[model samples]
Target chain A: MSLSITVVVVTTSTALHAADKLIASATAAGFDVRVVARTGDDPIADVVKVAIAASSSEYVSIIESDGWLSGEAGAVIGGFLASHPGADIVYTDEGTVGRRGRIDVIAKPIFSPERLRCQFYWGDIVLYRRSLFDEVGGVDASVPGAELYDLALRASIAARSVEHIAKPLFIRSVQSDSGLGGIALESTRRALERHLASTGGGVVRAVGADGVHDTRRLVQGEPLISIVIPSRGIYSEIDGERRCYVVDAARSIMDLSTYQNFEITLVLDSVAESEVISELMAIVGQKLRIVEWTKPFNFSEKINHGVLHSRGEFVLLLNDDVQILEPEWLESLLALAQRPGAGMSGGMLYYKDDTIQHAGHGYYDGDASHIGLDAPRTDPGPLNGYRVEREVSGVTAACAMMPKALFIEVGGLSNLLPGNFNDVDLCMKVTWLGHDIYWTPHAELYHFESKTRDASVHAFEVDVAWGRWGFRMHDPRYWPYPHNRPPA
Target chain B: MTEITPDEQADYERDARQLALVDRIIGLEAQVAHLRSVNTSQALRDQLKEVKSSTTWKVGRLVLAPALALQRLLGRNADKDK
Candidate 1:
């Protein structure tokens, strides 16, 4: 099938040479190319509007001058469009061309509206259906440096379907400033605020050096959040002092959390000391409920029993070894979980030694592992991955929150694999039911798990997980570029 | 917003320092692990070089040269026939 696509090259006076080369490359690749020269006076959105208006192609792509299309881009895009006729907005993976060669490849995730609101992760080159573009009113000239971001946000909300081409079809110059700062930062903030205002009321706060913003949605009412923590109620020495783990966890929630409309359901083993239970009672007061687990040591069963005893609109599965760092951590997770189509939301967890424990779960090569394990908190990850909220394949149930109704709908956690990969199984069920799981960096917690890592992966659990959800290995949400591909 | 007390501020500062120290230690450990692997690889390369320069290895290669050449010739002929 023949697919006519118009490539609108948005260029500045300084990059006219690059613009010409890009146009030549696009033309060679059998795409209609148009140049929109920006004299640094008129808004870029206005020039792009004119260029798009002059085009008669069914599909239109907007790219910066310093970006070049790959040799197979036209054929790949045409094939994809032919296959997915309902795709309204399409984007591809991109890489940076340095003096040495092509370096720093960015294999972007499938269209994530949450990630887009945090940062402009959908590189410079994006193909939009002309009808969808016109429906979203092209672009907002008032957004200045963030016109494309604003357009993407508007188009994503209005588009019928958004598709991601995994092939790296766009190559950008390394010298181009993709970092958020100055006017781009201000424009991003404005765009995000506008997006929030239109979707739902939320406050945007810029976090991290990479211009990642946190959108705190204003929940309409105070829905009770039930925090389910399964623990042995054992004592651990922290900072040279012996403290009951459950009591410390309870105390941290009571003292540090800003959200008050919540309850704590401690699913403790029956062997737990009475003194520890009394101390937890003292700390949590009337907001705490103890569910004694008489069964074998099964984390899944403990959580399921905890959920059965609790009554709340939302349920948060938290480990007893965790200490809340952020005051509004509960609110942060709830805001994302409360959003439409959001299945589960997890927080950024740090080890006791401060390296990352879990950013999100990434499934690759038939194995599920933490996306950014042991990476320093200062590292924002590729394209500010760790600093922004985005859809993930799964999240560690150590601190995952979801609506109670949705949790029950997915049959809670699987009891077959009671220990390991149970959270992954639960998340897979959630996504299988067509809901997106989100991981947010805004909610910070220190997971003081034992120093000796639980390196045991039972063959039984692996077989069960692999048998049920083997298709997850093909889902590339967090894994980027070369890492996403299976081995030869 | 809840106001943070002086004690909480002190605790945060201490935790921050500890975190920085832990990060540095982890980085150093990674560097050490990388260096150890590089050293091991270099040792293996040197051993291979020594074996390649040995008289026995040279004699073996010289003896196998005719056989290898004949195998390649036969493979090319088979490919052409196919």
Candidate 2:
């Protein structure tokens, strides 16, 4: 038996020619074609509904007037649907075709709810199960420019399974523009706010004109956060002056951070200088708890010891070389960590020279590395990856946050990895247990990396990590440019 | 034979190329899974090597060697008596 698809082309009087071309192409490609005329009187959503109501098919695809089906869209979509039997909603990678040919190929990631809230990354063409469309009540006519976005959010909430096809199946006949317009941005913001309100209450603030947003989930009551820092109380030369990194880190948190209901658990080396401890105490005041590390220099072991001594609902793993850059950095991390299905949350870290240190971790080309390393902090990166809060394969433990219970549940960091790749191993463990690790640009910090210890990676550590998680070396979320873009 | 139009030919070639691309993507996904399985096997072997070279394993072997020799001697004596 074959699955049937109805292609509903929404068009206006001026773009009827393009609509005709789309109808012809869809019909030739073995899809049921329906055309809906968007008069100035009726809303676009109502017009689409009329067409959908008239058509009878297993699947319904909504496309704009200027968009047409690719030559092999039918074959690819059929094959995908056959394979993914449980998928209720499916969207494909899309590109714009002009006289110069195809360009701006948006190779979308596998169903990211966080990314969806920030922007309408899913382009114009979307295929939905007819039943799912009806279940989500078609679309809201009130959201003028973001009708599809609103529908998508509601459908995602109700969808049993949503899948993404990396292949570009939809072709638009115009050049894509940068950023959402005024009305569109406002509509998208409203849609996002409603999405948050329906799922869980959160306030959405538009970050920039590029359709990026910051979502602050209403955290229920102030949860005491335990910040665990493993330090040797060593001094680093900054601007020709010797400064204790741990003391400075503690001072930055005390002075800069807006969240006050927290304590700092410093896992100091037993042989640390008395002056360093005294400085840390004076800076952190009564909120500091010190735990002496008598064992050898094992970063994972020290963190585990610190967590054992501290008491908080959540645990924040901070490196001593880091300084808080934003007043609301902790607030951003905590809100995301408190969300449902979140295992860990991390922040963007910059180097001393204002270059990106860690945006997130990606296991590309069979090696774990930071996603956007050494790039200017102002760069919007590929697919706005550095600008939005989205799910990642792993996050650096240097500035990561998670529930204390979850930390103990994943057995903290692995002892086998004493120093290097311990964070990656911990992230892998969290992902293995089916929890999402999120990275947000909203949380900002500066990491004076490798200030206290040797940063060289060892061969044995690589062997151990690859031996355990070699299968998961490929990251699906890190779809950067040149990899996803079509031939120019 | 029926003559095919140039436009129809272009469509056919385009569709064929796209279908091939889809097939290639599917093939790559399967290949990645196969490679992952192979890598996991190699990793297990490496872990086994590490365990075998561990001090605890060496000490266990040393302590069990004398017990095994006595058991062999006792077995031979019992067999001779029988």
Candidate 3:
């Protein structure tokens, strides 16, 4: 099969050296380049059409003025398209070339159509099948700030197959003064509102000035959420005094939580004193349920048992070591999870001293690495992804919430695999059945992590995980290759 | 999209072949690892069980608690310095 691709450079006016670099890179990759300049009067989509017409290749890729193609990107895209002929649109992982040197190494997941309505996870380095492009009527010229998003949405709807390459195909230079402008936010809200109405019903609202969007799923009355926490009633020293994790976590949920309609189910791996149980009952009254597990410690089994007893519409798998920092945290999580196509929703976990514990789990080097692990709360991780609600391969089950129906559909959690990758396995299983896992920074929590458990993974558990899902880890939907770590 | 000539087409063919070969090699390595894991996993599981059951393990974990605390303290201090 012939691997043919044309490079389209969209620019108002190209920087001389930058253009030279782009031309050099394209030539090196054996791809022909065409420059498409905007006349201020015409839409950007018109400029794109002119560029596409300039070449007769099977695949068309658009490069912005501040972007350059990665080495062998043309060949990579061409090969991918040839092998996967059904794919209408394909995009690759990208990074930014900025004043602080190359940053924002955006390692994107596989095609997430629902997430496209929320945030743009895929950067500008996209390859389009000319047929699909023409079929979708190219990009919507009306949406200047969200032109790619609008085009992507239309293309996604029309596409029989959508693909993502694990490799970084393009590098964008950061614009210092640029942010997701007012026009972009408004357009995004409009697009999302349309998306929600079509996919069910929801309200899309832009929160604050940070380009943060809240896609509030239409509540079918006040749904009951069952918050499950696996507890040992473990004590740890905090702020010069010893405190029980379960007590603190329970206290936070009972006091700090603004969401009223919820139940707390404590799955105990250890026996608690009658006085302790009585004290907890006195605090929470009839809202709490305690289940004893005399068997061996299997995190998955504990959760499964909890879910069996849960009566709520939604189940929140929470760790006893976490404390809710925001009053609206549960509300935020439920809002995102309740959205269409959401398999699971997780919050950004922070350390007691305010460094990040978990933002999202990124697959790297055959294991799950926590994106924004140990970074400061203020740090805007790769492409400011840490600051927004977007789709990820998976989120830690520590604070993940999903509908009870979906949970049962995916078979709760894997029983064979205990500890480490069980949550990841559950996520992969859920995603395999076509669902988007969303991670949001809006729901914040302070995690006293590795406090209750020894945090040890048995070798059998690791092998089982690898045997079952290692083949699919490089699928870009789960784990992308070149496995770049998110910036701190 | 631009038309590729015979010469550029040949280059693309070579690049595609190389990528395909790399992917195959990775797949083969994964297979080998899986086979080895199948042979060794049971013994490793037993070893893990034994270690967890040992008094030495309990003592070691308890001894490491203060070290972890100090390490966290230093880590927070370093972040503050930054």
Candidate 4:
């Protein structure tokens, strides 16, 4: 196929140099560049349209102003599109351009049209024939933030030839100042429902039939994970003095067999005693990391601070109390967490006596004003977590694996929450945004759960049981009360 | 959205291939276990037991997982923190 993938950058009056850098990068990759800037109040669609018309190529790709295209992006993109002629448009795995340039994660979508509805999230880095726009239609120019997802869904449904490359090639800039804005996601969900309803449900059948990388499957090329065991105090309440177990946590970590990629994250919390730090250093040997945190008590706070100091994308938010149950715990967890729609994922929690602690989470409505709570006790042998792939309302944050950005996006466990409800709050907020939470039975961890010692030991759980309404306020579907009885 | 750079493309391909290799190795392990479990001859069972202990697999795995995990740490963003 004779293809010249021309990148179209729509520049505002200001960002010319950044736009030029993108053009130069694309040019270096042997792609033709066409600049589409604001021309006297012309709509952005009109601009993109004129640029697409000007490009005399079989395939036209797009790179917006303040955008990035990594090394040799064009050929890979054009090849994906050419190979899949049924696809109307092509998109690469979208993420951010951090200090390291590109941090793209596996895109795993679990809830299809049933619960979580749309995938046309970012439209800027998509590649398609110029004729696609000319034939069906183009961006409406009237819709707001989610305009592209809407337009692309329409075009994709109409043309049925839209496709995507399995590589990470795009970065949708983080609008730092925007926060979550005033838009309610439930309202967006309603709008999406209306849109989906309007198009008579233009959902595509067989999402991974194209034979490119399946969006639901996790990519496997990353190396082993190495964690830094920070110099945190290993204090046991059993004695006034600090302690280490017969088999230390660091040594236990090294014992894991499914260990292709993993690292320990050791942080030197300011409060950790020097003796304990020294002992940890002795235990970890080369694995100890003396990280800096401005002194925080909450487990969520400690983990958030520690992760910022972490190197692995697949982070293990392990508590000092938990031990690996089996050798395949990690690979099993990663395999499950790698599934689509799983933003914050965790697994089966068991007690030292081998009883189930938590297989998944729901909000506690009984004793608390909506602190995150685990699913009411279930027999671990029956494998409640292993049932099937389904959307969950919340998950235990004590041993969750999620993207660092998603953690930051949820405001890193409200500093005001101080204790028990923080992880609940984080999971609720995540699910509220229409993302799914999952619990897998395969990744079992022994949780030495010390709720009393848990920094979030709130009197509010007792108070809420007396009067206040709890988890019912946000999503009543996940309310857990005192009796452990299902709401009849 | 970002385009998949060639480096990332190569990385994905490599990761996929490595995971596939592990999957295959696991299959072989299961097959060996199955054959040993249903041994027809006492001599064959004894040989299997000896081979299970004497096989280079245990030593190879003991050294590899930690080493791989260490190399993986260098690729992460928190190399300095740990």
Candidate 5:
């Protein structure tokens, strides 16, 4: 028989427009649609639990009143279930219905446990197997806002295969000020805390809120960070004068930085002047160290050597061309790196002209594309999501932070991807190792933008990346919508 | 009116020389900055070699002189219009 599914439509009586549409869609899709209505302080969990108990179907598709499934979703889901009977939870790509009935598609990547811990990239409309749902306790009434997230976590913990439908199967109306309120925020916080506690024994602390929410998992004590810079002492003309990029970057860290528990390591291909070295030492005091790289200009090798020489617990790979914009940038990045599933944390970088350089990166075709590539400083691209702390496929190593142990474990960047793709390769390796890669807008920096490297290496590196980890790059979590720029 | 003594004249000359040396250093530093920007990586060098040998690149190179003149003329005119 066709895989039976009960559409658990949750909603209020006042907003019956959305519920009616969803019911119609479900009915047309040949699913036994069950509408669950709750009003006045009734928790989502209670409603969901009641619905699950009443449903006689094999699977329960959770959909909010405002959320509707695509015409093909029922068939696609049934097909997926028939193919993979073991999968307990299945989610699909979702779209936000905009004004004039335009749908902005949010293309999602396949399952990544690390991505889930950082941000809720997966949509709300998920088909849960009734058997597994019952086994893991259908839902917690206490956790209302993040009940779905909590369930996903529990299901994942139970070692349930959570499959993703690449095609968009759900659509929901985009609402303004629809951000998490007090209760919702609390629920989310509790959900994240429980997830962190269950996965890794650590103290979860909420960092930022409102539009850009951050919950950092602080592990034990204050971990030392080693800021490594690989450079050839290349000089750049800023304003009208010449300054060594490496020296300037070091000076910025020493003068403007607020992160006290960090050391700076300069990995160089050639010996800098004694005066320059002395000046750097004087500026950084005892926090400065220089390591000579005696071979070709291999960024991966330089970083590896720098890590070998570093004494800190975490290694921050930094380019010599970037300058610190925020005093708490390091602190923010460190917090993300200390998260339960995070293997790498990167910062939002701005060009010298104040345009957004790197807000996070999404891989498309064979190359890594920046999120807010050339948008103005405040332009929040499409959905105001560009300026938020979220899990990304990969982040540039221009300001990447990771645990030194994790870096070592992943073999400290690939030598094959010497010049380019090294950062992407490293991030992908971390993801492969069952850890997340995070890109935070909080940790801001001014990247002078590739003053030391050549782009020609990118072509060869792209070949190498395609050869080694090509499939992973396709269909990144950060979907490249046509409207990548901010709405007018 | 100020420098009548030989020692004062010598000091003035010394200061002038120092200033000249500083200027020269600044000039050299600027040149180095320009050179650094123009400097190519090993991969870029390989690409450049391939381009240099290519007939298309060679033909493009031949058209460069006129293109530069035309670009300069257009730029000046556009600036004037602005």
Candidate 6:
């Protein structure tokens, strides 16, 4: 029988005192453990190697001295392995104890080539097969503020696929002075630069670092826009026909917009009722061209399919229920998103009472999940805004637009997030690429329609969110996590 | 004798004197109307007794506070420039 677990405690003189509780927790969990410290010997790589070498168990996980493993973590991993013999690695979403204890995740979109460099890995509650770590040669502490990031990057590139247990298995707490944030940023930039050079793409060119202030000036001449809507039998609720939204949407677009340089494409999946299709076709005049697919209801796959069929430079992933608030929203959103590192942009969300649903996007700390964009609005300014844009850790899929190139680079959206929250994962992955995700007050939409609530959280939604969150670290950038936007 | 016939001069002087008398009567009539508006009979009865005694009721701080003390206190604090 394989040894149950090898808990490797990584310590440094700087924060060794911080790890006392975490070390004790590992011991209490009945882990056959190794506590290793590096005085001047490069702590990270040394610990990862020692942890891998000492383990005889089928599983291995690196526990930073400052991180606490959940009491039930050992049992959860043990059962997961028993169930998934072919699994190479199993990770859990971790909650960190920082200024406050918060849980954050690695989003799904990060599975793409953007993480090819050692710097792009963010959340570090890792549990892996010891053989794989040995094959990849474990962590390299020489990267300076980006040690484990390099190790995880090599493993992700080497692995067949990574599996997640969707539980809070590891607790990475915050100490007075943790280098996680600065290190994570360095890791991501290195990854992007590597991926681009490897694929013959040049280093990120400088354009509007100031901002693409006017969308028209940025990508002038209305580059084509393909609007995609996923349809179910919930037709009337979404609108008259899936097409009526397309029509009213087109009419609303035409009526609200002063600019005339655009076209609309509607992605119609096989809704069971003929009336749904007929209703859509009758209402959508020359304004919309419809595309039909018989594929099952996988939201990400459907979006991926829509992306391939589209010929536009920008693709707006929109829900059917939204009504136009600013007629020129496309121009404004396109303007902001058109900037150099801007990966995606979303409109403000409102409840029927004109209260805020979301400003752009906010994050979840372990205590709670899925906080809104500008919850209970404060002084109108970015606290640590990277640039002029209020840089959020992530954005939601409800009404977000992206440049096609960046979308493709992040591997479109994740097919695994069948019902919900694939967008948040995509948002984190793109932002990690040194790109900014902007939430615009100018681009506004109201979600009075509640079909989205059906998947507000299914079991898989919870599981995917928990698993995807396996990568995002809890830091000040997402501080006000578990916070709400001041209702508008 | 040529500059003015006695009867004509007398009529002219009488007309000038009558015009001056009419102007004086109009001025007196306006002053009486102002006094009538300000002087309520009931209030004046009490003030008259005080004024007769020279104990109250005054217009300016220069003197006469003894004649209209209450009236001076009740006067509006409005500025005179406007």
Model 6 regions more than 4 Å off: A1-221, A233-247, A272-287, A367-389, A473-475, A478-481, A485-488, B1-82
Error at A469, model 4, angstroms: 10
TM-score of chain A for the candidates in order shown: 0.93, 0.92, 0.79, 0.46, 0.83, 0.49
Model 3: per-residue lDDT, tens digit, A1-488?
23467777666653445567776777677776777675543458877887788778876767654667787676787777768988778888877775668556667767765456556666676777888888877777777656676677677777888888877777767662245667766666666676677666777766334444566555556799999888875555766898778887898889998889999988876565555566667777788887766679778778876776678999999998898988878887887788778899898998877888888777765667676777788987655667767778888898899998888766676666657787877787677678878887878999987423366777887776676667555444533433344322
Query: Model 1's A-chain: what TM-score?
Result: 0.93
After superposition, the stretches of candidate 5 with alpha carbons farther than 4 Å from their true spots are A98-102, A112-119, A144-156, A175-177, A201-212, A234-236, A255-259, A269-271, A293-296, A331-343, A379-390, A403-418, A425-436, A450-454, A458-488, B1-82
Per lDDT, the best of the predicted structures is 1
Q: State every prediction's TM-score relative to the real structure.
A: 0.81, 0.81, 0.71, 0.41, 0.73, 0.43
Each predicted complex: what DockQ?
0.02, 0.02, 0.02, 0.01, 0.01, 0.00
In CAPRI terms, where does candidate 4 land? incorrect
User: Each candidate: RMSD to true structure?
Assistant: 12.7, 18.9, 19.6, 26.0, 17.2, 32.6
RMSD of 3: 19.6
Point out the higher-scoring one by DockQ: 1 or 5. Answer: 1
Ten-residue region with minimum lDDT total, candidate 1 chain A: A479-488
Question: After best superposition, candidate 2 residue A267: deviation in angstroms?
Answer: 1.0
Clash statistics: count for each candidate: 0, 0, 3, 44, 0, 37
Q: Name the TM-score of chain A in model 6.
A: 0.49
Candidate 1 structure, TM-score to reference? 0.81
User: Tens digit of lDDT per residue, candidate 2, span A1-488?
Assistant: 23488878777766688577678778877888888776643458877888888888888877764666788777888899889888898998877774557455667878888777876677767888999999888978877666777888989999999888888777775543545556666777788889999987788876446656766666667999999999988776867998988888899999998889999999888778888988887898889988777779888778877776678999999999898989988888898898888999999999887888888887765677787777888988876788888878889999999998887767677666788998987887788778998888988999987423366677877766666677777776545332221101
Residue pair clashes in candidate 3: A55-B1, A55-B2, A56-B1
Tell me model 2's lDDT, rounded to 2 decimals: 0.78
